[model samples]
Target: MHRRHAPPPKLHPHPSPLSSPATHPVPYLHRLLSAAAPAVSPGPRFAVEDYLVDTCGLTRAQALKASTKLSHLKSPTNPDAVLAFLAGLGLSSADVAALVARDPKFLCAGVERTLSPILAGLTGLGLSRSEIARVASLAPRSFRSRSVVSGLEYYLPLFSSSESLLRGLKKYKYFLSSDPERVVKPNIELLRECGLGTSDIAKLCLAVPWLLSAKPERVQVMLACVERLGVPRRSGMFRHALKAVESLSEEKLAAKVEYLRNTFRWSDAEVGIALRKAPLMLTKSNQTLQSKSEFLISEMGLEPAYLAHCPVMLCLSLEGRVKPRCYVIKFLKANGLLDRHWTYGTIVRVSEMVFVETFICPHKEAAPNLAEDYDAACRGEMPTNFRFTWTKNRL
Candidate 1:
């Protein structure tokens, strides 16, 4: 019996479909249970990308880029509170968006611990709510910086008006990060040593706050540059010259000087004289210089030397003030109503009210369209046929 036992029956790889359920209850019940169980749900997920777009006003691309940096935000709780708090502080939606765009991390900052305290400190330093909103819009990181309080403490005293503070903050957001004792104080002292008065220093701060935060070496270089331009340190125009020189790079200053020399055929000395008279002329674009020079020299028959002497005339608007007034004067002279002795200097330098009273109002009877034509020219709608007779008279 043991030696002749038949081989065991072969088993199929799969169970037969016709097999009785009772015969293979384990496998059948396993399949049935699997089919009956509910699908395993995914874990709870945060929709940060959607949150950025729908709530924060970020574009899809901006939201994607900002999301990577802000991946830690598991929900919109913190950011929503931040936006609400900022809105309570009078920040518009656009302002909040600008702030968040500038520094997205600001959206995650703790409202009570970080943002509220900074705003309170700024308000304590006399910044109105609107100004705080502006500062936040311009430099959002300033709110989180530990140096903000100290920066405000040092700068608030320097500015007399809220407008000056606003301007300074808008121009130089790094005022919060800059070391007042080291950078600002030294630069201000250097300006004082350069013979700038308190009023002049205030004006400089209002005009160019970055200069106050300039490195000591750069401040020294700017001082030397202005002095080399033959601007007397004791002169009233010294502050203006310093501002002009500091505002421009050496390359820009050189280029502007060369442009004036080559275009106007002015000697280097004449160029320097012009800059001394009106340092702001260096701030004008090359296009402005070209247009004004062409009009004054080619059309008005004014000498290049006269322009170099009266550089302020070059600063006037070519279309608005200069051309319109010149047209009025020419119309008067063409009718023999204007005095031949009246100088271009007199015409260009008068206040707007005086100009209208003397040129536009009195000449209405002689030239009915004088005011209309002047208005048209001032609006940059110069008539195509507009022309003026050039006189060789000295002004």
Candidate 2:
């Protein structure tokens, strides 16, 4: 009696076209209804810090630190997918943990859109799954970018092999971020233009990857400095020379050049001759140059000009090859076992087996303890025969 209500509309066995599930998919219908429904308060906002610790395996400290980036993370849905994708890619728990700690925001990225495409492109480039995983773990910030695959493609050929590329990448943290076309490609092209072959470029890039990654203009200047050092582009040691000069400023390089000249008592022309022969001398430390000069010039009685003529001698080890072999040669000479004079360079550069065969084995009966004494001298010990050589020199 309070009010008359209209009768309820009769239900049809078949649903109306507007409400048909075929026309409006079930998921779409659910979404549409949700959109029309009045807003209800969402459950207590997702606990990002706790989720990071429990699900992502982050330490409380890591979670606390990483949570700041994911403060707006409302659910674990995207992170769950991302973690699953990483696992499928063969990333170990440590890899995932390290990656997340480095870039917590990476977890919130769309897996289907971002991660899958990046992985596919890298695979197409012939990188094994494991290598790709390591790449991601090594460069989290770069891995998040789509441009990383192209960067790797540019580097792979320059490195010549994946193993070599990986080794270089371990030292070069910016491999992924650097612009290959602008910075790296131009430097490599310049190297090629200077008569550096592919093999030579590969060796230099592995030795100092930043050479190519450095700003092209900066690299051109460095190349000019190298050219001024008197190392002809065709010299076998040109790459070695390049590595020596790239790290040093002009002032430091000048200091090194002066130190070498003064320490070796070289005339200006002689300095150029020595550097042209072994450009690696520019990188030798003051102590190294001093020690070698003292040994070759003072103890061995070799002329400064002789060493400058064969600067490769300075590249040999003082304690290992130079001193030990020189002592052996002297011991042989003092004992009258040698019939002919042996060049200092010949003794210093011979292989261990060759030295043992030509020097030790040939006179094993004459000097039974020669091999033993040589071994002792190599370990920086003073052998009796070595002492005898000194006595002979004094006499």
Candidate 3:
């Protein structure tokens, strides 16, 4: 029952594929794997081997991966052999270079599978490593400066639209349309009021196309034409049109007409014709006065004969002298009082005397605020039994 059992057969640990030394000729792999593998039991007999294995502590997994990748990188067909050989697993030579070059330690994954293709594309475009690095180092805004036009036309279009471009163009169209100078709104308005339509305005602009490029000025011109053409006054001649506006008169319409006639050297007949045509040229005052006078004499009991003499008599009272008496004539003419040929100093003096006696003689007052007898006032007396009659002569 106590029979001795044979010792269990000894089991040996199977060597890992990764345990084999790297045979790849890639110097980067040779250096990396040899340095990375753990030191053998007695430490390397050669100082070179001892230093590498002791200093770098690369794991077996790191060595095996580096060797396998370097095998492919060593091929002539590989575009980036040096870079690929340096890369372990997915890393490239460019990635190692960047990592070595950067003064500060960074946690970013070295350019591996994802970034390698981009570097490859850059290499295909004939971009040097330094140029790629420089571009990569630049911020987006700085990079755009390298190709502003291309950025706007092509790249920006990817983000914007033709309509957006048109809006920008419209905003700056003034600069395109005309000369920077020679643009003024009022001047344009002057031209437009002179009877220019939109087409005419456009033609004018075409004649001076550079004006369109002018800001406010070009816009002003177009607007002016629209305003002038759209209004009732056909002729865009604003100043002349304004002349017509200034011609409107309500106070002393006849006097204003005379003034205009004298100022413009127009004949009375012509002036009268114009006034008749545009009755608004007469002011409300003149209209009212005319209507009042017309109503007083024709509709009321006031006599036209007495009213006709009123203005001349008033002139006599105002003049304080019986003279060459042109003043009397002026007064009569102004008030529609004179005959067509009523002149001559003899007649004037006679009329003055009559006016002075009949109207200019002062009058008296009986009741307070009573209209007086023209003669009684001259005598400085108050008349009894005063009738409150109003007359131009008393005034």
Most accurate candidate by lDDT: 2
Residue 286 error, candidate 2, Å: 1.2
TM-score of each: 0.79, 0.81, 0.15
Score residue 126 of candidate 1 by CA lDDT: 76
Per-residue error for 34 in candidate 1, Å, reads: 19
Best-to-worst ranking by lDDT:
2, 1, 3
Q: Give candidate 1's whole-model lDDT.
A: 0.80
**Regions of candidate 2 where Cα sits further than 4 Å from its true position:** 1-64, 382-395
Provide the clashing-pair count of each candidate structure: 0, 0, 21
Task: Put the candidates in TM-score order, highest first.
Answer: 2, 1, 3
* Tens digit of per-residue lDDT, candidate 1, span 242-331: 777776888888888899887777888888888788777777889998988788889888888888888888778888899888877776
Model 1 error, position 25 (Å): 31
